[model samples]
Target: MRVFIVHAHHEPTSFNHAMTSEAVAVLTGAGHEVMVSDLYAMGFDPVSDRRNFVTVTDSEKLNQQSEEAYASAHQGYAPDLQAEMDKLAWCDILIFQFPIWWLGFPAILKGWVDRVFAVGRAYGGGRWFDSGVFAGKRAMCSMTVGGPAPVYTDSGVYGSIGSILHPIHRGIFGFTGFTVIEPFVVYDPKRLGDEERLACLARYSERLLVLDSAPTIENPNTADYEGFVLKSVQDKHRGLD
Candidate 1:
């Protein structure tokens, strides 16, 4: 399987970096083709500008042919968007490795989504909101957090980690039509000893190797959601009547 690993951690010696490396090793050793996009290392521009809105025109060619060719060739094609799009298109599985900053993905990763997941590429005018270019693909988040697991659990201070990550799981990956597997989170990195860290790393490595073996959740699209909304509305009206 072609795997695309997008690493968003800034620190070279951080636990997130180590996990990214371990994932790469495991995937590569399993004979899967892996591509790493280190956002910070690559100096990825996260800004989405007006230049992306300008349409490419070839007036010299016939109108229909030019438009068709341009639309076909340039579907979700832009200078800033091409690199990540190419990588996304090339991969069957996408693993996002990062540190959970402020209970979410790092700014760079968020920016990556903002810039790369643009109109005509990730979403568009005529395209269905939930049906993006990445449908049928699989995604997983391998994240490291500073807080303990207990803090993120139900009835804890931070609430459930799964609930905290619902927006990312439902809004981003599920909305874009990728089958999102359960995230693998490592908590309380600062509290771990060297030996414990090593054990954790080994376990993480094993998870990466057999990621496909885990069952994926069903990704509901806009159509599915619309039906639910319509049913709810009908039920409300019937109750009133």
Candidate 2:
């Protein structure tokens, strides 16, 4: 398997770094090719705009999607974006390693998504959900949370973890056509003892070994919807054909 990890933590000594390192070591040791994009280290500019493409569809106003479409047709992606797109195309499994900040991806990571997930290259023109541009690939989030598991539960203050991650899982990975793997989350890692941290790494290694077989979240079938609303829901008002 080929794995590409997009790491989004600034601190080298952080637990997120350890998770990424563990993934690279484990995957490489298992004979899988691995690549890491250390966003902070790379000094990646997360801001999306004309900076994403070398071509312009409009000069007076900025229409990002139009520019992206033009870039896709003209090979005009900025060198940095092109490199990231190449890796995304090359990988079988994509992993996002980051600390969950305020119930979502860090601004840098979110910006990475804004810039990297282009219209023509990633999704557009009836390409989304199961039929997205990355249809055959798989993606997973390896995240560390500041709070404990219970705090993220349905009845807890932070709400369900699954709901919290819906934007990334459903909107991003699933929309882009990657099989969404159940996230591997580390909660309150800072409070864990050395032994516990080591155990987490061991468990992560185990997950890496079974990347292909890992259980995945199901994506909505594009066939079931007319545009965005479910056909079943639409049928409730009108009789089914």
Candidate 3:
């Protein structure tokens, strides 16, 4: 499978960087194609605005969605943004490798989504969720946490990690029609010993090889809903991976 990994971390020697490097090495060694976008190294801009498009829908106020739709039709997105979209289109798997900050993705990664995952290209019109543009693809979040695993649990100080990542898994990956596999989270890498870190990398390598058979989080099927809400109690029984 062709995989696109977007790596967002500033430190080259950091564990986050190690994870991305390990992923590329392991995936490529397995004979799978891989492409990586290291946001910081690329000097990627996190801000999204009129700069996102070379095609202008309106010269006055900025309506990003409207402009995106127009750009999608006219190939108006700036070359850089369009390039990212092309990578997304080419990949069978999409992975966001980053350090979780404030319970979410970094600004650069978020902006990557804001600009690249635009209307008509990623999602728009009647296409979303199970029917979204990337319906056949699979996506995963590989992140490092600031705290220990226990701190991110149900009764822990930060609540459940699943709850913290709901917006990303459901709103972005799921909404865009990618089957989101369970996130691979490394908690408090700063606290881990060198041996532990090496073991962690080994574990990640194993995870990459079995992604096809890995457990996936369920996403609501559009068929089970009407007007974006569940149609009936029976609708709850049907879900898509």
Model-by-model lDDT, in order? 0.76, 0.92, 0.91
Task: Please list all clashing residue pairs in model 1, or write none if there are none.
Answer: none
| Model 3 Cα lDDT, one tens digit per residue, 107-202 | 999988888899999998878889999999999999999999999999999999799989889999999899999999999999989999999999
After superposition, candidate 1 runs with Cα above 4 Å error: 51-76, 124-132, 228-241
Q: Please give the clash total of every predicted structure, in order.
A: 0, 0, 0
- Two-way lDDT contest, 1 vs 2, winner: 2
As for lDDT, the candidate ahead, 2 or 3, is 2
Which candidate number has the best lDDT? 2
Ordered by lDDT, highest first, the candidates read 2, 3, 1
Each candidate structure's TM-score, on Cα atoms with residue i matched to residue i, is 0.82, 0.94, 0.93
Off by over 4 Å in 3: 225-241
- Give the per-residue lDDT of model 2 (tens digit) for 174-224: 998999999999999999899999999999899989989899998886774
Q: Which lDDT tens digits does candidate 1 get at residues 38-104?
A: 9999988766543333345654543433343354455624555577878887888898898888988
Q: Name every residue pair that clashes in candidate 3.
A: none
For candidate 3, what is the TM-score?
A: 0.93
